[model samples]
Target chain A: MPELPDPTHETYYSAAVNEALDEELARDPAVVLLGEDIGVYGGAFGVTRGLFQKYGPERLWETPISENSVVGMAVGAATLGLRPVVEIMFMDFIALTLDQILNSAGKLHYMYNGQVTVPMVLRTPGGAKGGYGPSHSQMLTNLLVGIPGIKVVAPATPAAAKALLKSAIRDPNPVVFIENKRLYPRRGPVSGPDFVQPLECAEIAAPGSDLTLIAYSAMVPLALEVKKGFAAEGGADIEVVDLVSLQPLDTDTVFESVRRTGRVLIVEEACRTGGVGAEVAARIAAECLDVLEAPVLRVAAADTPIPSSMDLEKIVLPGIPDIVRGVHELMAW
Target chain B: MEPKPIDLLLDCFRKMLLIRRFEETLSDLFERGALGGTSHFCIGQEACAVGVISAAADTDYIVSNHRGHGHLLARGLDPVRVFGELMGRTIGYCGGRGGSQHMCAMDHSFLGTNGITGGGIPVATGAAFALKYRKESRLVLAFFGDGAANQGTFHESLNIASLWKLPVLYVCENNRYGMSVPVSASTSCLPIAKRAAAYSMRGVTADGMDLLAVRRVAAECIAHVRSGAGPVLLELETYRFCGHSKNDPRVYRSREEEARWAERDCIVLLGKRLREEFGISPDRLESIRTEVDAEVEQAVAEAQAAPSGDDRCALGGVYA
Candidate 1:
């Protein structure tokens, strides 16, 4: 690993993503951006702001409202030599591009027997935020985590967002960088442009011994908040682990944490059934059953579509209170 | 129109014959249970593949679809390697991973053949974008069926290619039917080439059964694309003599329609042209057929003898 960059200044989550794209576009000529309104409009969430003026139209391509073909185009470009980072605007709309992403992009490398590599990154903002409703807001990370060839990564903080996005761009395989819509405005310390986090590892955000909370993306911060509140009240010393890479998951880190804590809680923003939490809980049951003191619990959104109203949306989505209650229940058990 | 050289005509005829023979062999193998899984053969659409690919430069990229054996052969892939892949041998183009419909020969500038309709259209468009971004002169050629023309990818790719002026040739081999459904039933537009005008691009139709006519139209479209005129949609009006796959009983069409297409068999049409226009002897053509048949036989034997891919290595190549 290269020397880690010292913390320079604080940056917003979306701005950090923009900084990584800017640095990559400047560092490598093969890097290009493609998506609707990504060029002139600077992306739906402004994650690609000012890139159009900096790199011009050739490098920053503004595509029409064609999600399927746009991803297909990125896959094609990646195979040929260009490292295309495609923005699908919202993770919900990735349904339209599933054929290209799953069949074409995800299967091409294996199907071609490694003759081609899709060195591309699909960056999309997901999770219920600002009451975008069921269509615009979704934590569809589960849809991609089960895919074998594709890598799925979600960054919870501004620094990790920058480092992971940069690393995702440099990876040779297809990577789905899931960005939570709600985390965009949050600010955190970011290292210099040279910092790059590994793609297949988990970071221990807060260390404890009484219980462990495994979460990713927006849930990581929520898990940390629960831990902070628990420590302030002199409750159980809960540990928080941020799973940066969801697929090819760092099971070692998770297993190690589970063994030490004995009681574990898996948290996610997706719905309760068939979510990433289920997978984590299953893995823990399989490997750490002997060490576990109590049955593993999960804190996730209710099994329902996100409503447009913030009140209804909060009810459907998991929140800090839910995590707090789940932690208390696990400690009591 | 000035006549093409006799040697070039003869080469095209030989290639079409090879593809015809290859498809026939695959059908025979499937019947005998020698090969598993389904394979889509471009039996009657040989001229379209040969004519369009022959017009392209060796460095140009090609994105083919499910019915792409002729396209791969015309792109200069080794018959033995193609056979090896279809037979599940490790020596295949994709190390036996990608079967008939999914093989890719990157060294030959041939991208993988897609199983989905219009799947390769956007891919070729993207390849063209890459070529243009790097300021390369080479272009990309995408092949899809008539049914694929109605796919959203076709329309989306053409629009992007035209808007960006990407150098690519969109070849729509309109063989009348997309599997069981005929073009007239599935498509709302008459003459799929006309759809190109909506994207502000040039479009043309060619006699896909006639090698010379296809070659002529493809050459013109290739030139237009090579000159950075964006992309062109060349609709090759042709027909498939065989059923959609080997299993179809032709309940959808009459014998008369099948006979009408068989009479215009691209291989036979080219052979007749060679005899009349190029003054080629019938015996010489017979020798070429004999030579190609023997080559196909040899490839099949070699592919059969080659070892199957190891099951343990199946997990490999899933990521770079």
Candidate 2:
């Protein structure tokens, strides 16, 4: 694994997103931010806090509760040589914008014979936290990952969030940048403008020979915690991998790690049935089947609605123990 | 002003004729299994497409719906390329990846036809926002059916366009029926233009059958929108001579209804205006029609002869 470069600054995950938007807005006159309650109210997660005051209403537009139109407007604005970053308050509301996202924005380049590019980022908060109920909390990255066109990036750390978002905004293709609500308050090292992780690659946080534990977004921290506990308690020597870009997946890095470790455990906050973990596991099995000693396993949320209660929510979502258990079981083979 | 110029009238008449002949050709070709997919023909509503599109500047943008062949052609898209797309040829606009409803020519500022009803409204609004943000003089003309006026996106798009005072002309081609349901059945007799008041924007209705009348209203609306007064909702009361698509038998309407709309055909109305008002001889109009037919024939032959788009690299061009 490459040595981790020390970040130049430390800030909250939400602050990192704000910094990325601030940088992009300042850098380009055509870059605009539009969403519901994002202007004076900042944002649902306050990611755009003070941006409206900073950039003013012209660049920072406060829109009505029109999710489909918001996304559609971004798609249109992008075609006209403006980079637009739209926000949907909750990830689940993306369902309302699927026509604009999947059919229009995602297929535009390909369908239009590459005459246009949708240089836009759809930033929305997802994952189970704050007991926001079923409508608000959903790791619906899988819904977008299945799409052929748009890039899907779920940044795990504040540093990654800040960097990937800046990259996503600049990216010519449409990008869906998913943020975890739980990570908003968490503070982490965020680099300056020059430091940005590529939106297409995965990072191996910890190196090990025993097993490869893969996760993204909120699950990455839990996977890292599992790695720390295993090292301290003299369990398996687990390597942690963050599959950042889910669509243009970093399968090469995963295939290399799975080949070395001979075991894999994919984790995700989404449901197990058709979650991104299932895709990662399937890819590993297809490519690393010869080198693998055991079947590729996945630790994902149960195929049920996330309960409102904290106790039920904890059980419904995969935790640190679930990652540790999945790792242990994968190594058992 | 001085008498309407002969050259401009001829151009409008030629555009309407091209659309009418193009749809007529598609109808024959579709019956013989020459074309691949179903197409929505705008046979009688040529005046609406030609009139509004002609009023805009060359740099102005346009968003269209499924029945948008007339709109694209009237905006000066190459008929050969348009036909090539329908024929699934490699040289077609969109590389034949997008057929009739999805054809787009970025250079012409035609944003392509949307498959979903009212899907193009917000996109056109956004384009207008881009123009306004850049302080460009270019405006956007978004064309949809009367069926789309009832969609939530229609209202939401109008609201945003009005709020921002974007340069956009929202045109609703009220062809009376959406697929099978008439506008009267779907909503009240209150015309689609009346809904523009809810967004606090100027709304007007035009005679879709009369080419000169449609152009006059479109000219005024385009001027108002270009001046940044706000977006204008201009509803053109038109009719489609054919079914919603090739497969649609159009059992919903009667022959009497079809004949009534046929009497006020946009092409015939324009032909009378050109001959009676401009005094262009019938021979001259007949020669133009013959020339247009030949042009369409050549386009069809070229599109038919073009190589089939290879799907071996089907996954190519998805990302960039």
Candidate 3:
């Protein structure tokens, strides 16, 4: 086993991803990396850096940017019993490869009547705030999660990113690993011997009863910040639920918390129209409507496209202010 | 071209004939309104699909485009299930989730074909990468038509395949038309094979009408990758015998042009070559044809008679 790094050490999500590759390669020879620039170039986001040299071109594959092909290849490989992780350059690019993801990889097992399994993970950079504009920025968590066969994991913190990625690779089921570029640098405590979530549970960032703030990926960090502010200003314990997974939602956890707090607020960086927030809100409303002390609320990016300017980008993407207001409004309601 | 053994040649002939009859059967059912939805016939493009698939191991995977029945049947997919799927039966490869355009079969190494052009290219890379990762020597043969070669995924997948030297063989069946539009209208390059130069891979064109030529070229491409030389692009100049699908009247192609290509029917060409050039007896050729016809009929009957899977299975394969 590679020596563990010190607890005080922290790094970017890119670094975490690199570390995951290193660890998994060391752990199992079957885990492979395939995508554009994943080998010699180290991937578009540098997630597969240094891996090509260590694992060689055979293990660390540099593939053509055929998202559909990349995913389809992984599905084929997984059926033959290899654990493959594919990096789909961007979440928005998924639309180009929807058939591969939705039709092939997503439904292989059921389509084959349990004769096969696709043990693969599609690692993709998603959500807005990057200057890439309409072509690149996309919140695909909702799209992937809506599919039945796959689980969509959006890791908000660096620790969660590494742990969730490892779990996704090892899982027998196909998982769409949606990594938020915005939260790549955020740090938090993560225990290991390695980890895998139970697939349908929410991780409680902080416990509280005044209001429940439910969020995932980049929005989780902003929710935590809002929770801290609320604790200091109003002395209220605003529980924060990090929905590490958008699909196979941790509805039980969020509903239980909301039922206790009588107030709830959902946050997302995706556009308000048909964003992941709608699905989360609908779940809460359907399951715990009577138990809520107030109506569930949502704070998300506006319907317009994300601006190129960093300042405007930050303003449009949900932030602590919007989250605080949403929480406060729910608390008062 | 390397001389192929008698058994392999016979298998190739069977596969091509099977595809011809299978599509012919579907054409009849579709025109008769039995099989709804779109059906892109590979009637003329049989050799390219069979040639590529023949060189790959059963476990080695395949990724295909929408007009993929030829590729699917070439890879030895059960005709009945495929027909059942087109007819919206649970017996279909996709369990009715994917109709005519979205057929999938993992057991036969026939990964599902997609509706989008060039959509399965990336997934082919993923499958090959997975195979390499597991130390499985499995390769991926991805089949796309000339129309798909122009999609963004074609550039992305080819570039990646060349850069990484992934074990992939890209077979572009340049049927000279994308629906009603000719290749000249949709593509700027003189030959689709030339596009491989942009990605740093050797590209070559072959006679898609001659089963021997397609087999020879496909084997070479597959051998190049299996030998660790990396991916190669193959452009097979062919034409679909039928309309683009059940609905396409193919107004873009002149009857004269169609006749010119039809003069080189891949299945018929191979049978003649076998009897004339290889010294196979006429009785042997007729026997093979009878066998192919009976096989297609049996598969169609079995698939039609098989019980549609339980409706509760609607959400069955989602998990595994």
Give the true-contact fraction for every prediction, in order: 0.86, 0.87, 0.66
In model 1, what are the clashing residue pairs, if there are any? Answer: none
Cα lDDT tens digits for candidate 3, B175-256: 9888888999989996899999998998999988888888888888888888877788999999888898787777777899
Residue-by-residue lDDT tens digits, candidate 1, B23-73: 999999999998999988789999999998887788899999999999999
The order of the candidates by lDDT, greatest first, is 1, 2, 3
For A51-153, candidate 1 gives per-residue lDDT tens digits of 9998998799999999999999999999999999999899999999999988988999999998999999999998988679989988997788777799999
DockQ for every model, please: 0.87, 0.88, 0.41
Error of 2 at A316 (Å): 1.1
| Model 3 accuracy (lDDT, Cα) | 0.78
Task: Look at candidate 2 and give me any clashing residue pairs.
Answer: none
Per-candidate TM equals: 0.98, 0.98, 0.86
Q: Which segments of model 1 are wrong by more than 4 Å?
A: A1-5, B1-4
lDDT of 1 at B6: 85
lDDT by residue (tens digit), candidate 2, B1-320: 54456787899999999999998998899999988779999999999999999888878999999999999999999999999999888878888888998989988989888888999898899988999999999999999999998888898899988988999999999999989999899976478889888889999998999989998999999999988799999999999999999988889999999999999998998999888988999999999999999999999999999997776436688988
State the lDDT of candidate 3 residue by residue for A72-177, as single tens digits: 6677678777888888888888886677778777766765556678898888888875576776776766567667788788877767677777778788988888
Better of 1 and 3 by DockQ: 1
